[model samples]
Target chain A: MSAMIKVNLDLLLVQRKMTLTELADEVGITLANLSILKRGKARAIRFSTLAAICKALNCEPGDLLELDKEAE
Target chain B: MSVITIMLPALLLYVAVIVWLFVHFKSKIFSVRSGTASTTDNRLTRLVYHFLDFFLMFIILVLLMMPPLLVVMTISQFDNPEWGIDIGVFSNLRIDLNEFAGLVMEPSGIRNPEFSTQAVISIDTYSLFAYYLFALISVIGGVVLLYILLQLRTVFASLLSDMALTPENSGRIRKIGYAVIVWSLVNPFLQYFGGRAVLRDIAFNVPGFQLNPAFEIPIVGLFTGLVIIVLSGVLNEAARIQKDQELTI
Candidate 1:
């Protein structure tokens, strides 16, 4: 199986013009978890929470996450 | 006629149907597979199982409805002097014309008869039929539910043994648990409302038990049953999630 793509929450927030603190507060997610999510280090995201974040940021899920092929 | 004369044949038919269905499907459901490649085959098997499950539920509903339908028919056909004599331990139990008339009239006149000649206001034949029907359905439903629970236990064990759980599967299990919980909560309320209406129509007056004035009162028995089912689902989901977490670690 191909390597699964990781989310880029920081890039998503930057594109949406939302600060880390603002996004974290709006999404009801902890600052630490938000930081981990921004750095693409989080293991998983719940679809419900993903939807909430998407709504809060006015961005689609694809804008926050994508798949990339691992280097050979 | 002996009670066994009527009950025995019905019992035999019930046993035969249950046995035949179990024997025919047991092997198909429990058969070991060589490879895990065929998603199509798995889906087909699941579809078949679901169909059988629904059929069994339908049988239960029919069994339940039979008595009420019979009773309604009997009540419609009820006549004034519809009594039959039955030989018992203490002479013949008789429902004579005068006794029947007395019972029908005594409710208005307020004179309690002596213990020996205490007129038994016989239940309408249809009502008796309905009582028996409900009793039979309750017994059968209880037994079938127990059997299904046992089958679920075995299937869950086998599935756990054969496969490693994933987060996706765990999520699916949780969703199933939620569905069961919702069904459990709703089923009893529906049954209770239906039952309460029927009882009211029949003018049922049990000595100790009284229906609450509030129509919105929850059916506690149904709620308890639902709680049990939802708990089982929650436990299964928890187990799946634990397995997934262990696998991830």
Candidate 2:
């Protein structure tokens, strides 16, 4: 079974009217590394980083990550 | 006259290479001063390192041309009316004086009539071929090791900028380690065959004399390679950790 973790970070950022650069600064992470996470290329996310990102965006972890079982 | 004709060009070329390397390193010394001081920053160490680098390269270049030289030498030996072949596998071995005495004590009928045990040994074509083949292998191994060292010089140059722990440098270290291990593994056999080739002309006809091949194992060389391989892994891990830290925020 093919599985992919879809990051809804962009959607949350847009809802919060926050740019990736601002989120990265609040989360204390590099823009490039944050972009990697945002693009779903990260194999696994650290709980601390996830916590920081969710805190920065004022959102829950579930709102940021979801398992996509079906694809077009 | 023919020897002079052949050697003069080679001699002139070697001198040119030496001059060029000296100038190249001398120019590099100025640039190196602008960079951060490395482990090999001092004038003496740089001089020794560059000298060794150039010397190894010269040796490797000479070695690369050995197959042709061996062919010519083998042909000359073959054409030499004074020396003839001492055939058989035993012809490639060295026998001791005790073994000679023992051989003489053996039954006279058992000895070959043609092989005069007391004859002065001169290399035969077949032995030269074998010698050249093994020596060529050893030389190739040396060439690979020298090339790895040359690459390491670049890695060290990068180190002067305090950027020594990159993936590329770590990979170069691993390559050097691997090259050393390979050379160490092949060297013993090369020594054995090379020794045999060198002694190709000495006929060991001592009655009952047996032959033994000499072996030279590079245990220290093997250990050095293994240590370098481990250090490369450590460097790679350190680089990874540094990248993670840089990405952390």
Candidate 3:
């Protein structure tokens, strides 16, 4: 099975009209951490952290992330 | 005082706590049944809450057993001074390789070498075997518990994505995250204090070995705990927003 297409968190935030600065402040995460998450470079995400991000952005995790077929 | 006495009271207190949780939750269940006001149709919430309750019960049981385990180790060291094969004399204690090996190996044997000592203590090989088995079980149990919690998080996130984010839910999630962070911060300290106390009691017998409690105070535990809680919150919020957007579309 192909690896799932992960969410582009940065794009999601932009589409939701949420500034990175605002999201970072609301999530209580360092700007650096938020940057890492947006860039999809984070090694892992905790359930709680994901929940906070969703709550702040007013979006579902699936909206930010999705499963898609990998290129052959 | 032996470990048993301490454990008896602790066990009773733990049981009381468990009973209180049950009663409180049970009352909630009754209200849910009788009350005309119901908001959500999700059975997953109930499942998650029940899972949390069960996990807490297991944690309490593990906590209850810790003192007895420490006491057993202490008594074992005392009976077998040679059990602690000193590697060197760091401070007043004798440091020996054999003793260190014995600490990990025949821990109980080093304590009560005589068959006349309590049957459980005297059977050192069996005791070690049992300990190894229990440790394995505990590790597996922890892994399974973590997996279940993760699953619950996924479910919560999915459900939240479908709903609008009310101020009440937001506040509740924040409070839960704070509680989790606090618990994580305190846990290591408690473990260190408890471990140090047990080790100090046995230090007289294990001459070379020192109990290092310094590693317990860093923000590592709290950080991880906070991250987990925050992630859960993010997922729920994301779910809610996504749902609202879909409805709008």
Question: TM-score: which candidate is best?
Answer: 2
Q: What level of docking quality does candidate 1 show?
A: incorrect
Q: What is the DockQ of each candidate?
A: 0.05, 0.12, 0.02
Name the regions of candidate 2 deviating beyond 4 angstroms.
A1-6, A24-29, A42-56, A65-72, B2-9, B30-61, B64-138, B150-174, B204-212, B216-218, B225-249
**Which is superior by DockQ, 1 or 2?**
2
Enumerate the chain B TM-scores of all models. Answer: 0.35, 0.62, 0.37
Per-residue alpha-carbon lDDT of model 3 for B174-238, expressed as tens digits?
55566556655654554445334433443334544333433235377567657767765785677
Q: B1-249, model 2: which lDDT tens digit per residue?
A: 344555566668668866876776666444444453456455555555555666666666677566665555455556455644443222223344343544455445544323324322334444555555555665677677677778777775665446777888889899989988987887777666655655544464555444444565679989999999999999999887766655442
RMSD of each: 15.9, 8.1, 18.8
* Interface RMSD to the true structure, each candidate: 6.1, 4.2, 12.6
Best model per lDDT:
2
Off-target runs (Cα >4 Å) in candidate 3 are: A1-72, B1-46, B49-95, B98-164, B212-214, B217-220, B232-249
- How many times do residue backbones clash in model 1? 1
The clash count for each model shown is 1, 6, 44
- Tens digits of per-residue lDDT, candidate 1, B14-127, equal 677667767765665666455665476565655455455545554564565556544443444344355322211111122333334534555534345322232222333334
